[model samples]
Target: MVPLLVILLTLTGAWAGRPVLLPPPHAADLVLPPDQWFTQKLDHNNPGDDRTWQQRYQVNDTFYQPGGPVFLMIGGEGPATAIWVVAGQWIEYAQQYGALCFQLEHRFYGESRPTADMSVENLQYLSSEQALADLASFSAAMTEQYALPEGTKWVAFGGSYPGTLAAWYRLKYPDMVHAAVSTSAPLLAKTDFLEYKQVVKDSIYAKSGEQCYMNVQQAFADAEQLLEHPIGWRSLTSAFQLCAAFDGTSSLDGNNLMQILADRIESVVQYNEDNRAFSGHKDANITIGSVCELMNDESMGVPIERLAALNDLIMTVHEETCVEHRYQSLIDKMTDLDFASENNDATRTWIWQTCTEFGWYQTAEGAEQPFGQHIPLSYYIQQCIDAYGPEYVWIYGGYDQSFVDAAVAATNAKYGGRDLATSRVVLVNGSIDPWHAMGVIVSSDPALPAVYINGTAHCANMYPARAEDSPELVAARQQIGDLIGQWLQED
Candidate 1:
């Protein structure tokens, strides 16, 4: 559920020595954003704890008419602010339906921390169950405070992990939430997410052709071999313009270094949008297709030269937040006190969620995967233990492997991850989004339909309508609107 935007910002600020960039234009400087707060228990299960924190939310009744629908835009792992109300897809729908729009920040995210510190004890309260409860509580309190019209239909909207929450909310709280729009939601939770890389490969090949894919594979292979020799490793350092020296330490091994480089490309593909500049690549061509074009440019001649060109392109995108390209910085960011502060944190909280609830580890498993070899699933597992604890059973009630398995089994079963059995829910996914591998691609029933937008990436449909949007994306948004309108009219 960790947003890649958050990951990039955290890494840049902690190790790359840069200030965290501001949110998108629509979300910036919202003129005293009308944010409201609500009180919630630290743990809904432990009612007697009396521990509570103020949860943030914003309600826009500008478009609300008597008995109009209520649109609850659920926030994901990141912060939810007034800008979401101003620019999200739901705002258009709100205007159309004369509906009240609300954006509720997720607990443990944004300014809604239940405790002063993110200690393991305090974070036990953070879970999907508690978050859904927050939505229900907020709804009740809001209705009472504003005296909302009776029998007003409620529709939930979210993208990515928040989208999963939207679907789960509709299923778990049917009476409260009438319909849901979940975009690019990874409903199925798995430990080994090999399919992620496979999708990345598919997206690259589909857009940039087979030669580009082969070039990427060759680049990683070259990196793997280059790191084996001290002289070649030194050459690699200069070729990639690494800020730090590789002292033949295991921490900055070739495989890890290559994966770090590949991650930059992955980010471009994952967040792909037409006309949007990637990572800070001002040129519109700084996208998945252009990345492939750069890598596949055979005119560059040697493998090292081709790699250098690719590295130069990535550097252009990330020049402002450039780091030494060392794995130790990653480890340091995870363990550093300053980096782990509640305000600037994303990794610790997200890693905890993956370690405990869902282990969607993005490992290099398939041959077609772009990342270099030697980066195993164990590497990420070890990271989880380092960040959280060796005692995996601490979160679960008992110390048994069967317990963890059963917990995952129960989660998937309860939420209907792969085969969601909900009505009045429209699931939307981008054809090229890496996370779609873990999402529901087929419609299980007429009441619950799914749409796949070709030539799109993560949560593209949720953004405000842009003139540069592809025809397929434009059609997909219209289809979503039609579905929502249909759901609203349902008795």
Candidate 2:
């Protein structure tokens, strides 16, 4: 990840490079009359803001008018609904604190989809640099359009990947967005696949009912054999992807590896009737029973070899269609060993990266790169690390050893200035959340402990943030929000 070319505007004037503002380029779009409801639009831009490309935005709570401090919502992976459902919270927050709330869907999902045929060449334009630009423009436009307090601070709120983005907003556009609230953000300095790996390990070895431990162990061993023998690179890659696709999906029941393939993969995979909004569990679906039962492959499910063989074909074609077209170059390099370090484990070689083309292979002739943006996201972390200090941004792990080390190095505080805003972080884990464990605390400074929330569940907001009718939770959440306001205090 290259260091983000942060274009912070201290000028306090009309922006240059007027961005396009209107309906999306192509897609059956919907426009709702400004009302207090879930008004879904394919692509809409604020008429203000002059610094954006044909960037897209999804506006919520548009009816909340010209007075309050505006809140910009950042959605996580996939076209999520929390931005709207949580609108209830912001409604009150706005009324109480005089803040108006709204959210934008991330690239690659929903109406915010890139019009450029989803190829890497065009997708590279979708990098965080562009997103950051789009955000800045969006913020400025909103500020100008809403005519809120002359200096009403803009706040960025996100969880998971978007959580890291919020933290980044403070680091990059500190003045534009004076507040950031990041929940379960993985803002390490390096490309660590360990974060997801730990989830797999815990799901199999530590948790009950889901035999992920015994199951993955065997699959991993078999995968190792295939890697060594090279009967076909296809099976090995398939097994690896099968293991890596558990982040937002996996459940207490079984490994319906099928659904992981559906929600995430490029294929047109179908889902059972159940699909609901989740903050943490983006992949929560009706396939948990089958996914958990996948551990019993030897007894009742598809053979590991055959599953790998079949999945290799399915996921490969899926990637070719969804991921391949955009990130052709990245994908080509994905199979190579150029990026793999001797220090990195062989176990994680085939896993897909949310950060970089960690795979060492180069793309084949004529294939398109499906991944958007060439900006190594690591650069953003490094900027934070350099400016904030190694401890400023953290890589918390619950025994995801690989990820822990990678994250610490990637987002180390050694990148920039020394005036640290946040020097400690907590990697909270549900005691049973297979994503993390007690032994993996990278830095137990105690100022911020890697909290193992006992009896609480993994992806806490998956079912709770909405059901949070408890006055206790609401008051506690309010305190957190206020703290966020104070954290991004203007420099």
For 426-456, candidate 1 gives per-residue lDDT tens digits of 8889888888888877775888888989989
Question: Quick one: best lDDT, which candidate?
Answer: 1
For model 1 the local lDDT of residue 155 reads 70
lDDT of each: 0.67, 0.35
CA RMSD for every model?
A: 5.8, 14.5
What residue runs in model 2 are displaced by over 4 Å at the alpha carbon? 1-52, 62-68, 75-98, 105-124, 209-212, 219-459, 462-491
TM for candidate 2 is: 0.50
Where does model 1 exceed 4 Å of error?
1-32, 247-255, 274-285, 301-304, 320-325, 336-343, 390-407
Error of 2 at 269 (Å): 19
TM-score list, all predictions: 0.87, 0.50
